[model samples]
Target: MVQPANKRLVTEAAIETRLTTERLVTEAAIETRLTTDAASRWGAAWASGSTSRLREFFAANTGPRVAITGAPIVGTVTVASQADASALVGKEVQGGVYINTPDLELRDFRIKGDGRYALIDFGPFASRTYIHHIEFDGQQSKDTNAGLGVSSGTGPSDLRVEWNNFHDLNDAAHTRPGSSYKYNFVHDPLVWNTAAWGAYNPAIHPHTDGFQWLRGSGEVVSRNFIEVPYKSVSATPNTNSCLIIKTDVAAIDNVTITENYLNGGTRTVMVNDGGFGLPTNISFDKNRFGPDFNDGIWQYSNASSMVFGSNTWAQTKQVVPTTNGSLGYRSAQPALDPDPLGFGCVMTNLGYGAAATWGAANDARYVRALSGGLINGIEFHVTVSSGNVSVGVYRGRGRGLTHMPYDLVATSGTVACPAAGAARIAIPETWVEPGDYLAMSCDNVTMQLLLFSGTAAPLFRPLGAATAASHPLPASAPSPASPGFRMPILVGTFV
Candidate 1:
């Protein structure tokens, strides 16, 4: 028997479920079609064929988890009213999900702009929202800041954003808070490069940070990747950045950044105070930077207590300390010194690492000399509560056990605990050769030493007691019982 093209045989697999309620089944309900158009034709009472069709469709659907299916949404569907905000608990839409609402969750969609419009705009009052797993196409948008994804306004808090992808965007994300959490919040979004826009214009491109936070605190940014591209236009010849945290009025404080991969940009972080208020209580740990990425952190403002621990860059251009309040080219750190002094270079973080270890077991890691010079100072991200810690230098010769020669060139005084990021201690200058196998050791404390991820494998050696040995025991065989890992080590020179 020849079956009709529209006719189909009813089988057990075809029947999903039996409905108890009796209702008229319309042709649209049974139809299955693929659409390339952005807007879906939802024939409802409030959603007439008009300019506000997209907004009306959302206004009518008050379900907790409203799923927007079919083609893309064309125009801006602004969520302006309080009633509309209350209805959207978990609304799954396909792109163009703008938010002025509180406590909303937007996920699993591709959001493209309409040229000169923002795809995701968190209005002046949005709060407690979650944005994840969305790819934003920002090539069509006119400018960076205006057409950005996730532009936070005055009073939003308790937000967790992760796994979002962005490309060809000028401005990626930022916060405009009248205020700002604990470490409960995490941001791990991705940003790629594109040449859709021109090089730089002070009027058009004042700042195009991949991730900028003007206000609020207690949030964590980790595992995020950002690529900075070369621009086509320029007035001041600006370079696109990976992450920037700057503010004018509200005090920005207590944000923890860890384990981020940032490469190819003008600046990694521009901690701008803008003369409003200095940011305070910020920390950066376990981050990696590509070579020639310009200023690792361009500081416009001073911080009360900030930490740049376990971050790494190329060994050729190691980080240095500066007095002019900017980390240009090298991994120059402004937070390390409150008063300006062009004393020593402050190297940025790099290499494989390990978590901090306390107790009787001493912790040590292997470090290779990049450009051998006088070792004047060394700094490590040490966590402690009450006790004291002693740091030192050593020479070794082995891949495994007996890596370093059992002797100390210099050592720092035993310092007290509770040192957040300002634990940089000066040591007696010791000359070292390039490609030297050097090891950094610390006396046992009740804290952990944060590690950096690197190309080389980490090396560890455990001490038998809490106090560090000035000269370790020379071993013939590799110490199979030693604990090892790669971590950030800065060797500063006076010359």
Candidate 2:
């Protein structure tokens, strides 16, 4: 019997053992530094009457780096004042303040909309804004307006929406559960017999999409909690999904839907890609669809370039619409890999399915040799189609305790990455001794190697250059039985 060429073999026999004295760095550190800049805070007190003072405050202060907040404002505050909406870029309205603005951050506020109008109506154009940590209260029943609506137009792009809660919009026309649900009624009558909402006679928005992205790019909807009560809609269509991304004129691109908590009476995500063009580079990563999430993830369409990774389901089987999109669903658990997403790539003790990216583009960490051996091949998994990838091996040149420049060890020839699946690259042979800190870096190009995923606080190395910084391995290599940070590097030659 002969072992396969690419298979890994570990053995213990009568042989000399040479050990390196470098200590293992246990903390999970990436080379990229997280931003520590905080938004400037301004305070406001909610007063009785029109609270026009709040509106006046916004008209005065205008800057790119300022955040305003009101502790608690009473009454159903109506914001007709378009205070400095044009010049107020990167400004945030926070803490129970009700506002309507374009190109600004609407955060930490309580927005109330009457049955006749929208609570937050982002005009025909807006861009580069943040909407999060706010609560939208609508008329429990007979609410004809949307909780958050964006008219069909331009500039609803480059937005980061997260950690917001939407409930009590009462998105159904008439929800009466009992025999009172007259089937003979001429109009569509929604019936919900339960006591989910204290006000049960529901009249929902015409298009009850929670966050409607009519035309946008670089939009990320993540970690949001949306709860839509039972039997909410009667007649109007497209009122189901918590988030709807559609365009009759432009294509929605670079939208990432990840880590959301959607619980309601309707579908999860609705992508109508047929209107003008299909949504491209859409990614669904680790979202939770609750029992109330019905219909499916996508309503219907022929969308392409989608990556659906490891999502968790609660109390219901996952249902997705049939579409012509090149949908990539990672559902199977890989053998010997603890990742539920079944990505066969792992490099950490942290369970698999948690994927990381490395290279000059996403610069995270390094792959160092644990023993004295010949470097042979590099194996990795990719998600994109075909592209040129340059793989480089570097040895750290230490100068005192500070992180140092890299010395080239071996570089793989230009390799072709597949549209999907495993990629193996044979590198020019090289030797490595124990305690040598080596790094495997990819060129800043299309496609990235899937790294072991985890939530550990990352360690950072100071590159000291304008574009410097990288992950360093331990000064010493551990026993094969006690490997630390099992990165996706899996090929080494026995010396």
Q: Which prediction has the highest TM-score against the true structure?
A: 1
RMSD of each: 20.3, 28.9
Model 2 agreement with the true structure over 127-235: per-residue lDDT tens digits = 4445444444553434444333222223244444433344445331111001010000011112232355344444543335455555556655543344331221212
lDDT of 1 by residue, 43-81 (tens): 331132121232223222211222445566566666665
lDDT of 2: 0.38
Report lDDT per candidate.
0.46, 0.38
CA shift of 327, model 1, Å: 6.3
Ten-residue region with minimum lDDT total, candidate 1: 179-188
Q: Which regions of candidate 2 fall more than 4 Å away from where they truly are?
A: 1-103, 123-126, 141-156, 170-207, 229-239, 303-305, 315-495
